[model samples]
Target: MTTQPPPRASRPALAPRRAVGSRRALASRPALLALVVLLAAGLFGTAPASASGPASAASAPARAAASDVVAQAPGPLVWADEFNGPAGTLPDPARWNQEVNGSGGGNNELQYYTGSTDNAALDGSGNLVITARQGNPRGYQCWYGTCQYTSARMTTAQSFTQAYGRFEARIKLPRGRGMWPAFWMLGNNLGQVGWPASGEIDIMENVGHEPGRVHGSLHGPGYSGGSAVTGSYTLPNGQAFADGFHTFAVDWTPTSITWLVDGVAYQTRTPADTRGNPWVFDHPFFLILNLAVGGNWPGPPDGGTAFPQSMVVDYVRVHAPGSSGGATGAVTGLNGVCLDVAAAQNANGTPIQVYGCNGTAAQVWTVAADGTLRALGKCMDVANNSTADGAPIHLWDCNGYLSQQWRFTAGRDLVNVAADKCLDIPSANTAPGTRLQIWTCTGAAHQKWSPPAG
Candidate 1:
């Protein structure tokens, strides 16, 4: 059972939890009164808002205005919150709510969820704590009779749901027998047909028993756990999970959702895997945070499991394309695309085609972290290593071969390693098949290609 920390001067208060996986969604609840007071009192006074852009007065950090909540990686931050205060006071209620009962949720777990302030609360030290405490046995009750345990489930439903964007969270799991902590999302269109049909994205999930590992999984028609598309990573040995917090992320786009832990990506899934099952991930989904006691997946809590155990949520964030709808990074700048056996199937000697960006073995390209592109396990060399115009680009095994390394100048021109010849876009801006030839190094805009953003 969670031992309450010694009480200090009273501070503020927040949300609650649930046992079922599909409890609540939508992360748009209004900030509670205590949270507002703490915020005004500058609990985050100098701390930077969890978001990426300029800090606004309304969303001041509960700590210091200059203190940033966390680090940022790829994509732009659209929304986020660092629970830097105690439990009780959470983000605004207008953004969140608790889901009651099973709305045909993806998981077949049992539990009728309810939203109660008691389930979620803030402890004095800056953590949005969600605790699952054992409740006294009531009866075969529907209306407050016999109850064994209670927890919190929070979500961003009414306000901040999005389709095709990266969503992430930094969290510390409650270490106890039976404790279940999850950061996930469900398709926003659940009011109609509901689960599998609605789609579910599990960005991060951990059972108390196995604290050092986390799983990134997806569930849809024909592919739920036991057979769902899933991947997991274990932390370095001796690194206790309770030691610190880690960031878990999912980059959701029209084509796929790439999963990353810390900054390294480990898994990616595509629509093809579903056999055209209708990718429901292409729509908006509400964010959800919950801590549960027992479930079919982890089975029931073990004897070692303790009650009143709390999970600490640091923050949740989402990023999307910029207003101009422009690309984020350069595509040509990429060394070569990683391709799998399926992607490598091209007529021998046919020029390679640029397919969607996937981390698949086929699509994996080695770009020098310093900025040179390598392709097909070799440097992209100008045909004949020539510096003259109309030089064809060819692939040869590495020999430190001058013909093999061609540097892309500011313009799309590829500068030959052997000579100064540039890889020019013949008749620049032609259709996709236009052959790439070498010419004098001339700075032109047509030679550059930026990878489209998320």
Candidate 2:
């Protein structure tokens, strides 16, 4: 949350969690049910996303029966704030640093932000509640003359920040007039360079005037104030964002930023989108959470506004994306067809065929963090754990067997760890109906593969 009214740069230099994993899903959803049955039958699926691309259906982190993917090894848990403490306690000071001020946040907000419990506290219900009260609660006076409200703003500026990857938070927002709540970031250069130059990323922001929609924007050197690059996302079914908690995230890379709300990606901003503007987002940034009263964007609260409003935060997580160095997508070979499950079938000993790429899910593949190339939650394996050069490959239950663990190297070979042999197409055939088998590592074109383009 910035001090408003500055030329989009009140200390323009801005800001910028962990390994709290999602719980293992039970037999509650039909998709997961498919996973359980398949795993039990020793069958896993293959690329169904189409031949042209990963496909929109397979994007957004692929949550369909995702629990079944079972990360070969879960990515490193960098930092997390689970907010699991009894009610009325402060967030772990070791992880969170609070900002205390009331200078209207440059946005002409009315809250005299406080560091006291009256504003920020964890409810006994596994949530960090950042409450905004209309009147003073702890008798602490406002920084401005007779301010009418008080709130809390928390940050991880001094604790943690990563250059790139995934950052997410699950939050149920507050409602009513004059409320301005946000989860966002500022560049780490704020103290040295200042606003716009330091940059700002609004991961999630909601104004009381727009309860059904949340906006994501970026504030940089030339695009500050009302002119910042911004966009809005409205919940379908006429659902008010304040009705329930939703996950907000941004997958940042050197070239672009993709925003997701509730696991659905709605926007992707690339260098091309702001061609003339300087891209300041390539640096490190910190995180901030705050609920302001009467910010300029939402105008001042009217009589209809509610007091004691709170933003209930469920969890914040940051993950270090696992190795992709190049082994995690489609496994292609001779003739450029993909290594596929015959007819996209999932069964024990389902022959691994070389078929024309249709971008089908069966043609897609993922080399897990643990070096296992899997489809439909099952790994590519050598039949009967055979090591002979002619041994066939098939879709078998993923048992973490050496036969199931395959590794891809720049040498262009898929080496089965259990067999120490490479995947080969018989006599370097280029037919769509051919099946590939294990063969001595030859560094041949038949042993080569290319992953999906970013």
Best by TM-score: 2
How far in Å is the alpha carbon of 339 misplaced in model 2? 14
How far residue 122's Cα lies from its native spot in candidate 2, in Å, is 0.8
Report the Cα lDDT for candidate 2.
0.67
Task: Tell me how many clashing residue pairs each candidate has.
Answer: 86, 41
* lDDT of candidate 1 over 240-347, digit per residue (tens): 466677777776777667665554344567887675577777778888887766554555666787666777777777777322122123244223321122334322
State every prediction's TM-score relative to the real structure.
Answer: 0.54, 0.61
Ten consecutive residues with minimal summed lDDT in candidate 1?
64-73
In model 2, how many backbone clashes occur? 41
Please state the error at residue 383 of candidate 2 in Å: 30
